[model samples]
Target chain A: MKNLHVNFCGVAFKNPLVLASGVLGVTAPSLSRVIELGAGGITTKSLWREPHPGHPNPTMFGTKEYFMNAVGLSDAGLVKGVQTMKELRERTKEPIIANIVAGNIQDFGAIAEAIAELSPDAIEVNISCPNVESEFGKPFACSRIDAAAVTKLVRANVGDIPIAIKLSPNVESIVDIAKAVVDAGADAITAINTVGPGMRWNIDLRTPILSNRVGGVSGPAIFPIAVKAVYDIHAALPNTPIIATGGVNSGRDALEIMMAGGTLVGVGTAIYYHGDATWKKFTDEMSQWLEKSEFETLSDIIGIFHKA
Target chain B: MGCCGGGCGKQNGEETLHHELNTEPRAFVIDRMWEEAENIRTFVFKGTLHAKPGQFCMLWIPECDEKPFSIARDYDGEIWLTICKVGPATTRLFEMKAGDYVGIRGAYGQGFSTALTPSPSPKGRGEHSKVVLIGGGYGTAPLHFTGKCHQDAGSDVTMIIGARHKNLLIWEKESKDSGFRTLVATNDGSAGIQGFTTHILEDLLKNEAIDLVQTCGPEKMMRAIVEMCIDQGVPCEVSVERYMKCGFGICGQCVVETGEKMCQTGPVVSAEKAMTFSDFGVFHRGAEGQRKNW
Candidate 1:
């Protein structure tokens, strides 16, 4: 009886694996392509009311352990985001979550309101990108007050659309921030953006690798932090849906996070590590694990460890 | 075997599954630089890549832009890239000196498979593979390396190079010197044969038995060659280019209309697959991943 489908905040996903924001999230066709490859939902890359140039070339680099991107939130802006959402929404019945980012609290409201007109499955407010420190110093997720204020503002503008506040792992108390956003009217929480605005120096050249010098760390390196964050968030707000995204590269990793209290597991950097089959591979591995464990359904394991 | 050994798991051991590797552009000293033709220059870095023919490197110039360049040659623990001063990045590269430093990452892309058998009949492995490589301008750069591979593997290699004029044709001398058969064509009839690479390919197909055809150049020219090969039932592979932010497959910026993430599924695609891309031979995505006519 076990199946991968899950209903998160009234939106039914074929599986819990959502295409994480900011990865293959730009174009409608590209987003549709991810869904085609087996992602249960689409989370468009963080968009702003206006187009962002992001950073220059050498924006990203990777290794076996981690993937670093200082892509500085390069997006074609909200107009394109809406246009792409419309196109992608028409193609598939799978849920689309419009992920939006901004420099100020009010702009978050404005962007969220604009995206609400399209009536996406949900709206993910991004208050935590580690790479844009120079432009917007210290993400709002660092403080519970700012996180709540941004959440309240977005909740006010987004009409009845479900709101998931994306938080950064760099914070000292993810649970406090999660509770604050929930109290401020967020219906769900996407735990952990990229960890550590980390950097690397090409020692042979004796210089920095990324054009922005430092970028957010992602991939398998940050999976543990993601699990811990999701664990705490779900423990604090057991009723609120949680989208756990950091580095769930395999089926076991997906189940591990859900066991740690994640409702929807997000897969991003794994695409780089595992190729286009990242979604298929994650689902296959997850289904196999579930079958072996004799779980009646995938939802039966959500926050299972927290029960004990 | 520092990084080239089978342990890396990149196209290693049994399955020849080539993949995109996570890479940072590490600086390499330009050992030498030379002028090839009008607006074309070759830079040789004191660097080596775990790469094969038809693979590329993301060439970076400090304050300039980062662009992918086909590895013209990988020899003597050094990497060579050919560039034409067509854009901002290449112009910056053209301005650099021999002693200067540049950055390169990869040896990425699913490259050409030298193991070729003509389609339809599926020739026996007993006979040496005969490959016809067509290059337009600097597109011939990688095919130069490819011709060497086919020749070294005991296969017969013929390189048909095309350009707007004689001065634009590249890799002719290198191909001939490497002992592969060389053919040339130009729009103005200033080289070996006139008209286009397709004209040369037509004659070659009419006259000889080609086990495979690999081409890279202008999209339209390659399209013609691809169509011809598909029609004749000759196996073919073509190297394609598009606006790519990352050489790795994650970006999805380089996914052509056929849903082919060119960096992963190909920069080298079989002729049959190319036809299915619908977007192939038509338009390519610009920097913003927007479609623009070829």
Candidate 2:
């Protein structure tokens, strides 16, 4: 039997396919549906200390290849979200990764500590969300000091559980940001979130189509950029587990990210557009191609395309 | 199509058939695409789409925004949308080829009345009624077939269209012979009247006895026309536009602030009801009734 199991941040998944957060994890019932459809694991929607109603209207827009969403991190708060996770644990056999975000370093640590008690498979500390006007905006990660401060706070408080820092690609150099997180004691990293706040104007109406005016851009358009970011981060921290995200639409996309040195793949907007079957598509199709290509395992593909 | 019943391909726990049942939302596919005017293209799609005019559909092109567009024509397992290449979604839509799968969902919002079901006449022909259809720019597409449907029902059809320039006037040749009277308006005096379509409509309402008035365009223009109809006591309907995410009622993304659900109830609403919109004629609404100036 071909072994499909892969280890992510020291935890085992039936395969490398995991449902990246956002709307995919908004409610427990939806999360259960994702697991039933065959995802190796699932990540909860990013949670914060307080409930945020999110931005003004028009937070999400869809295009042909992919979609752009700026739900403004509308989460149920750490306590409520942790409770949902506990309920999820009862029904799903798949590993659950909790995603946490905070306005400041203290909240990040506090939420990390709270989720740690629930015993999730791992924790993803999201330090970058470009679509909203939040405290962790450009100034926080534009310099090394802020990134280090937040990462250190989470590391100090989040007891022995594996901690991954989800980095932003909007900065001057992603390498500098990745280094800051690694220096702060992050065990792994999920590179890139949705890119730039974009806009759409209706010519007939002669006005901007989206109510938010701008939102985070994702899909095939950001695939190349995300891949490059993952490649660079993996090269910079060869030992750090990197979970690749952004514009991963299919199993072929998953394969490319792994070849670019991603240990696991994070799927978000694609799941919103295509639903849970996308996760199964990524795993089943990639497994078939991997076996047909005579590759023994996933690690063989990691960074294989980035040989210097 | 029958509902999935949330129970498909499951018999005795042995996988008997392998036809993949869609576990997610169905996307729109453009089977044929062509430019009908400068910056305007007609996308002919063949899919299992069930949509009606005034009911919006979300068109997704990978790497661009998923946009909400009105269904212009629906027939025989095919759908058509006459769109202006505005924003990233339409711009990318212009680059699509035949057979490219475009994500689609909808038949959302309230649609137009099916021509009053026609009262039976003693002569076996429906009694003639007077219907005036007004459209501005691409908003004209939905009204085209609607006017045709009216004409088919033995109603007198008059179509008044407005665009910024003369070149933007499309389908004039086709609509000219569809048993309807055509009136053209442009921002510049190059084509017909050198003013907004509402200016011409105001004159029409004052002189001619119109039984039904249907309008769709910019919110301000629609509001003006609706108000005029309200004052004159003409039965009026307007097709509205809003930023929609899921074309179905799920995502609450494309809602107008009538304090009513736009996706579930309408993109097409009575002029009397539209006047109650808090954001009416002032701004556009997003998924959650957030305003963007009209």
Candidate 3:
């Protein structure tokens, strides 16, 4: 097939397709398996400074077109997170993106500093998780000041290692938030953590589906929103790298995000629809489409919509 | 992929067909509900998900959280789900009666073989193949379906079921009625043999010329059976249970220590592959994927 390699925020990836955080990225073994399956890079599940139990059972629910989850960013804490990264580095050379989440701004820096000790490929500041609003109040990404504060703190602690500020689409103006994080020293931006703390209910029992009653909605339903988020952010800051994550299920969706200015396509929920080999299947589809279109490389299409 | 004997291919094709049909939860009318054992009820529903022996379905009780249940029976298009009253969702499910409406999707995960043409008997006991099925607790639910399938395929199936006591044992009469050689064990010796199912399995492995050993039960018991099968040089498949959120592998809650997500790769895995999981008998992750003592 065609070469699907790409470089994002100074890190080389075999393909633009990356295993998004929170699918099968909970452990080192699962992360390594995703790398073996064909993911160009893998992001660990959002790590906390201490172990967070997250929400109770019925934390997640899925329909054919959409999946909603309120896992509450539960992780084994920074100690296990560092050990997992160390073990992962020993096993595979695949790029590792350490995703850090915290209740307060200072904890974000503390966790980032702890993870930086292990020297991951990049650090992703998860300031936009919508599902934990019950425990943490509003997401940091909801306000530009809060978003920039979290990014600036993490950026100061991580040294020179690139930091990607994961942004939320639920904000009033995603472009403004993206600009704030970029101005605050974010090396890259991952748009759209999940759309809405949406809900599903059982009419018969008159009760909510998820134990949390509401969760971040993902899967095919959020693709257009993600593309628009990437497009808007890219339009505002052409120099800032973007990792577009939302509802990318197929290669066409990945190409759409790239065309809209995404440097990498983050896939998580699609693993349910396509199985573990989703990355390979998506890349193969993209290669065949590229070959037929006679595009020499991914850069030829990345941000093509901007020119149009 | 490990021990289903050509069932995986058909399952893949059926999955594609189901995907094309609709991803929405289909309405299943509960036709019957039998209180099989203490805090356990078996509900048979008229639905249209073509599930294999070891595969599972996401039983949706509307507003009460969808949980993954092993396909206990799939007679024609009627599906059976045996549930234990464990949590809020299942407690709500237990309160559900016949003619009630519930939603079901998938018949997901890898299952035990339905097409297992067991090796011919070594003692020349006709063309019937000898297959041993050991079940413990609620784990016996899925094994009943597997035993029936094997029996229908002209396999001499022996079902050894164990529970904490006689009142806890499920599907014993059903297996006996189906012409399966039924054996029972209880922890308090209120039934057939005193001790765990593994002890009976050890005796069976020694005396009986068994072809395949299939088991589903408490992780410790299953792990013990896996070790015994390995020592006896017998190929075995065990059904493993884990906390599953999204039944199609999106949620990582059901992943074992071997990095295999049980929701997709298996609920039914080979004893060899199960042995590879460091947490096989030791621990399982909870809803948030935190390691919990099994």
Number of the top-ranking candidate, with DockQ as the measure: 1
Task: Quote the B-chain TM-score, candidate 3.
Answer: 0.91
Candidate 2: misplaced stretches above 4 Å? A134-136, B1-294
Candidate 3 structure quality by residue, lDDT tens digits, B173-264: 99999888999999999998999999998999888777789998899999999999999887799888987766666667677876788877
- What is the Cα-based lDDT of residue A114 in candidate 2? 85
What shift in Å separates residue A128 of candidate 1 from its native position after superposition? 0.9
For B5-66, candidate 1 gives per-residue lDDT tens digits of: 21111331122322345387878898898889999888888757867778788988876668
Q: Report how far residue B145 has shifted in candidate 2, in Å.
A: 17
True contacts kept of 2: 0.00
Rank candidates, DockQ, best first. Answer: 1, 3, 2
Docking outcome class, model 1: acceptable
Please rank every candidate by TM-score, starting with the best. Answer: 1, 3, 2
TM-score-superior candidate, 1 or 3: 1
Would you list the C-alpha lDDT of every candidate in the order shown?
A: 0.83, 0.72, 0.83
**Model 1's DockQ?**
0.41
Off by over 4 Å in 1: A292-295, B1-22, B117-128
Per-residue lDDT over B141-195 for candidate 2, one digit per residue giving the tens place of the 0 to 100 score: 8786677656655678898988889889866766787757999999998798999
Docking verdict class for candidate 3: acceptable
Task: Rate residue A50 of model 1 by lDDT.
Answer: 84
Q: All candidates: CA RMSD in angstroms?
A: 3.3, 14.3, 3.9
Candidate 1: tens digits of C-alpha lDDT, residues A61-132:
878788889888887777677788888888878899989999999899899999999999999999999988
**Collision pairs in model 1:** none
**Could you say which candidate leads in TM-score?**
1
